[model samples]
Target: MLEDVFRDQWGRVLATLVGILGDIELAEDAAQEAFALASERWPRDGEPDNPTAWLITTARNRAIDRLRRDRTLARKTEQMGRELRDRPEDTMDDTTKLPDERLELLFACCHPALALEAQVALTLRTLGGLSTDDVAAAFLVPFETMSKRLSRAKRKIRAAGIPFAVPPAHVLPERLDAVLAVIYLVFNQGWGAGRVDLATEAIRLGQVLATLMPDESEVLALLALMLLNDSRRHARMRDDEIVLLDDQDRSLWNEQQIADGRSLLERATALRGSGPYVLQAAIADLHIRQPRDWEQIALLYGELGRITRSPVVELNRAIAVGEIAGPDAALELLEALDLGDYRYFHSTRADVLRRLGRDDEARLAYGRALELTAAGPEQRFLAMRVAELLPPGDRE
Candidate 1:
């Protein structure tokens, strides 16, 4: 019941109140008051026929009463009360009708006027339904700092009168990228399907977005991508240590998810509306579905390179090109890429050199990767990979 209440009604309750309160902070306070009231009375009332309606109505009345008693807000109180009363009572429905409101809140939180930090905080708070402390912990920041950022963001949204609506269709292409990022961020929280221990609030957020916009290609792509990546989670680690992709047992991957991912990729590309998430999904699909063939993978990565122009994509393309064209050709491509700042680039280059039997170059590349990586799991994995290539029984 708690999960359903939060998943279906929290955003709508917040949005409805925000519309009336004209203040995000006040709206949140009132909505929370409604939630508290539900906690106390729902068990006794045995769940109302329309729980959301009850919450919204109760919250609206609470906000009106509070404002009526505040001299400073008397005019705004009357105005907001009229607005709330005029809104249809039947606006509340089952969770099915609430995704659009949640998506609108996501966009409002990410409005350009908010600082990037505030945007992240507000996204987690309002859309992700996380506490400020949880958000702070996720980012490794102090809770007080996150609280301040969230407070400022909500205040700014009210003060600036940011429209709580989706961007115009003409601007959807650009805006969609931000939306996809937030969804992906949400998905990563509980994305490791096999590892129930890896759950996070991000997963709940992803489920909310998926429920809200199931037809959105980017949403599908993000969900597919996460499922595919997570499908390999068992193979990604062994005995509490990370395993490199090349060395992991492919048989352990979840075949069902791979199939779903493949189908989603086809749909993502069918309309030819290619975005970064779709392109990345295609890349992940290549890795999991067609392990034996890197030609198609290489070409896809090349296209992704043009689309995103991130150095990481170029490095990934080099890996595919190496598998298809030969190590020497891929080495030439890697030479032109100045991804010294990225550890994965060197690790990949090392693997390519090892495949080419260039021991000296491979050793140097491995050393470079080791020097650059901060992730302990990755560092240990690289060391093991590098050790395997050493002369048999060299006893290093």
Candidate 2:
């Protein structure tokens, strides 16, 4: 009950604090204190009728106290004090709704002055209401390393005077890519790591993005792409084992998301959008269609590969090529790319090898994949592959 409200309202609460406090680090501290207070009091005093408004009131008071105590920010403290008195937003109940300032938070977090990784990290922290440890898990980095990175990012944002507001329309596109990349990375982390909360949060953020930038083709397409992929969430795993797309039960997929994604894709296409996101959305749409069109998907992946030149995109292209051409063609293409230690490359290679009757090589590829994989379902699936290929006596 309380947990759900915290998850849903944390961003709104924090965003409002950031706007009023005009400092990311300070606003975060205040928001955390406010939530902590809620956790302690809510269970005893009963839940507030307006949790968001209650939270905003508590957090703003804390921020005000901090600012008033700081001689360096005396002017800001006075100004904030006056604004608080004039508007009395902190006193609102059911009559007023908190402004969804998370868009401003996202843009501020993704300011170009900061490093790309910092942008992603900061957005997840504030917008997604993730703690530093959770952000570390998402990035697969050491806790201390992530802590330092986040601290540095916040300090940098302060030092650079990045505004907690959306950029002007003329400069919006330049920063749009960073914002989208941050959101998509959050979604992928959640999807791949089986964190449905994060995935759902990412989808929520995408919906907000679409509402804010209604005519932005890439924004719509990115939302479409995420929705299309996430529609299979329920069917992607079964009994703690990864389920391949070809084996998934269609009934388990979310039809509503599929319809929503297809509609968005159509909207993007109508706007003459052929960008990477639009292209990816188109390919995703093709995949969900019955009697799947492997050729068109392959061509779209080819174009996506050309534009992004990402090895992962090329790998996906090889998969579509494998479906259309054969395992041999896929293997040939896969072998040419330098994928480094990507787990998917080994797993895909192993599947290709298994198909070609190269049992020994396939086992080795599967072993490499197992070494790289940490997720339970994927590890089980890869181990199952290896176990089936082993000689009867050699099996564990």
Instruction: Name the best candidate (by TM-score).
Output: 1
Which runs of model 2 end up more than 4 angstroms from their true locations? 29-66, 69-100, 131-149, 169-171, 191-196, 358-364, 367-376, 386-396
Worst 10 residues of 1 by lDDT: 191-200
Candidate 1's residue-wise lDDT over 1-396, tens digit each? 775676467776776666556677877888888888898888887888877667777887788777766777657567777776676755545534433366677777767777766776687777665666677777667778888878877778877888787788997666766766665654554433332222345545555666676677777777667767877878988987987678889899888877876777676677574777787887787676545568888887888889788778888888788877899888889889987778888888998899889888899999999999876777888988888878888846
Q: Model 2 Cα displacement at 166 (Å)?
A: 2.2
Candidate 1 local Cα displacement, residue 226, angstroms: 2.0
Model 2: per-residue lDDT, tens digit, 366-392? 999999998677898899999999999
TM-score of every prediction relative to native: 0.87, 0.80
Instruction: Identify the leading candidate in terms of lDDT.
Output: 2
- lDDT of candidate 2? 0.86
Runs off by more than 4 Å, candidate 1? 1-4, 86-100, 185-203, 246-260, 389-396
Model 2 misses residue 384 by how many Å? 3.7
lDDT of each: 0.73, 0.86
